[model samples]
Target: MLWTTTETNETLAAQLSDELRVSAVMGQLLAQRDLPTVEAAEEFLRPRLAQLDNPFALKNLRAAVTRIEQAIEGKESVVVFGDYDVDGVTSTVQLVSMLRTLGLEPRFCVPLRLDEGYGLSHDAIDRIFDGDVPELFIALDCGTNAHEPIAYLRELGCDVIVVDHHQTKTEAPKGCIFVNPHVNDPEDAPWRDLCTAGLVFKLLHGLLKSRREAEDPRVEGIQLKDYLDLVAMGTIADLVPLHRENRILSWFGLRHLRANGRIGVRALAEVSGIDASQEMASSDISFKLAPRINASGRLADATLPINLLLSDDLEQCKGIAQELDAMNRERQGIERGIAAEAERRAADEFADEPGIVLFGEDWHPGVVGIVASRVSRRFHKPCVILGADGDETHGSGRSVATVNLVEVFQRCTDLLGHWGGHPMAAGVSLPTANVKAFTARYLESLKALYPAGLPEPSLRLSTWLEVEDLEEGLLDELDRLHPFGQGNAEPSFGVRGVVLEEAPHAFGEGNFRFRMPAVNGSRTGVAGIAWRMHGVPEVGQPIDIAVRFSWNYWRNSRYPQVTLIDWKPSGEN
Candidate 1:
């Protein structure tokens, strides 16, 4: 793989370091992120709640608040329909909880992934509404382009409010208070990329502010901060860029998550083996918490996690957490079998193709997205993994950094039934008989887009650091840039002239553990681990290595750990 380094502005870095009293490395990182002025860097480092823009600034938010107020005043029958993912579950819980506090016990439901498919579907609406139609219908995390379902609700004499973040396809739904920033707000708005949970948080903030202005006693003690845990989960899980208001929400949200104030989260964390007493990082949410929450949606009804989050009972939450964990384990086993098969198929069939399109007759539809992601990364090409869903093949597509799945899908729209998502990831469904045509069209489109062939895979180093610079001070400085995600990625440094203390200890499959010689006259060496390495580097020989530095919390103690990404003989770039 090719290794590249970001161009650094030394003058700006030095100026930031001097003015902000931060280490030179921190300043360099700030400059790399385009934080031009000291104020911008300072705000990025210390994101304050005061920095969040007014929720009322979002278009249609006031109308949504007014409609919700009418529901509260009349004690109208309310129903909140959400998707079957982390963002959707958390958004549903947050809005329903807040509405309950304001004197309305809202009925909440999430679409069953296997039965009703995704978003605001007529089948899902029918199942949720059954015989009783809600007076006020609120759709979270979906319904941006769900004109038919939104119209169906209107026909039932229901007022609709859709708080979504998905990009609109064709046109926006009519006759509803739609609050999607990507559609109605400015491109540079700080909250433009907020997920459904964050949007719901903003909605609640608006409702609370208006209620307080009206001297309502019920919302007096509603602490919005208490809901940040959910916001952080949704924001990080949904993979939105962590900048501006998103950074502020997630930065504080991780702290609130670590506090474990909510009984359900505390219980879920316990089952997930997360120590709530320590600093909660984005990886904890991405790898641990998010997967368990998503597992219920994939294998069963997503309402279980919503119920878990909203429940106040400790033992009940524990039972639900355990059930979700079991489902996740089941999901992992199913995913492993399918991924191994899909990888083999991609390598054998589409190794020379610009993209991969694989379909399995018996593959589980819910787990194909994860398999698509793994296959795409392993092959370094765009991939679409599909499973038999009735008469149609339905699944998801994952793209490499340089590819746009949405643009690619648009070229094949004639063969697709329904498809929509962001540039990097998307869901698609097409008739099973058309799968071959779609595959050919997908590959042809990719070739047309990139006539010179796809770009080679590469790893980018944030900046170079010396062995002496890998000290506690650097780690402390890195701490200020917590909760890294889509936009603000965790930095990986290129370190030169490193000699291992001893021969590395080989461990699990293609994995080994090594230690770097002591720096700054320290007694012990810095511990490091490398995964899936090609071969061990020579010991006692100076070499260049790319690594990510972080604290490894084990047995209730924290120690600096180095995660080796790549290494080569010194001077061999």
Candidate 2:
């Protein structure tokens, strides 16, 4: 596979190393990440809650907080309407928890994905209200583009606060206290890239600050740090960039996750076979925890996970966690079956095109997004996977770095109904009649933009490392940047010229494994595993490899190992 390596400035790295009294490799890694100045590097290395920007920086934060405060103080009813995804569920949990701390019982509703779709629907509001509508409604992770809903809420004498991160129109929701950052220039906004959970944390921060300033003793003992566990789950699950407060939240939240403070999260870890008692990382949340929480929303009602998150009873938490675990298993089976067929069809259907769009009547709508992402990554091109029901079709697309799925979908809006998302991923709906036309337009856009066809994938290398550097000590030094994801990816190092200790061989999974001597001249030779790899070379094959250095960990034990990204014959560099 092709790769791109970042050039290192030896002189600058040396300067940083001498000043910081760290390894040159650590200095270079920090430099490559653009934390050049001493203060910047220091802050990046040691993110503190004190360093978080003022919560009032979020647009409309004060207004939202004041409205909530009034509702609580007056004993008025409140409702939390949120999306069905992990972000929505977590944000709902966060906000509801804070409201309870303020001494108000808040009613919260999560839409059934199959029935209500995304955002605040009139019917959903009606269901949540029963007869007497809440005095105030807070919409989490959705409702920014909900003009009609906002209007309907006003008619019903309800105030609305939209805490969302999705893109919104210039006009904004009329009279609704809009809190999204997308309406303004995020280039200078500290809170722009935060996911809804992060936004909720900021809102809580503002409320706590105002309440404490006025000498409110009730808000005194609330640590706020205890809630970081939920915030971290949502941040990592939602794929928000791990920068600024997100990094701090996730970094500490990971600690909270490992401590397993929340009964629900602890039960989830146990049911999912994750030893959460040990230190947890971002991948654990992404792979183990997020999927279980998301499965509730995808395959069934999202309220299950939210209830689990809110519950304090161990028995109830365990039961919900098991149910979600089962749902996740069901979701996986469905996703695997769909992905297999989708890949086969793509191999034939999109053999020559720069992109692909496919739909099936029997496909599960909830799992199509995952398959779309998988198809896009597999083919390394933009892909749209649709689930058809009667005459209407809803589809989601995942884009490569070369193409913006949201932008492309917008250009082809003439063929779509409701559509919106970020640059890398998007959702769309239209009549099944226009599916073919939409597919054609989508391919046309891709062909025009990437006329040369899909470009070869590039494995980005952060730095080159000798096998000797794969020591337990280096892991500690590199871990100054923890909870790696999105904007802050775990560094992938290039290791040149190592002879295989034995013939490479495939395991039960597609991963290839072998051992080689530790170039650091240590007594013990280090081992490596290359996932999703095929075609093994003979013993003593001199090879240069790209690897991510980390601990090969088990219960109460850890040893150094390199996870290979790619490899070539020796001397290729």
The window of 10 residues in a row where model 2 has the poorest summed lDDT is: 516-525
Report lDDT per candidate: 0.91, 0.84
Q: lDDT per residue, candidate 1, 334-406, as tens digits?
A: 9999999999999999989999999999999889889999999899999999998778888899999889887
Best candidate according to TM-score:
1
Model 1 stretches astray by more than 4 angstroms: none
Candidate 2 residue-wise lDDT, 1-573, digit = tens: 677888877777777778888898888888877676877878888888887889888778999989988987898899998888888898999999988988899998897766666677787888788898888988999887778878999999998899988876336788788888877436657667889999999999999999999788889899989889989999998888898778888888888888888999999999877764457888888989889998988787999999999999999999999999999999999999999999999999998888889999999888988999999988887899999877888778888876877667766878887666778877777889999899999998877766777777788898877877777778888878788898898999988777776666678666787776645566657878888765665677777788888776678667777888788888774
Give per-residue lDDT, candidate 1, residue 360. 93
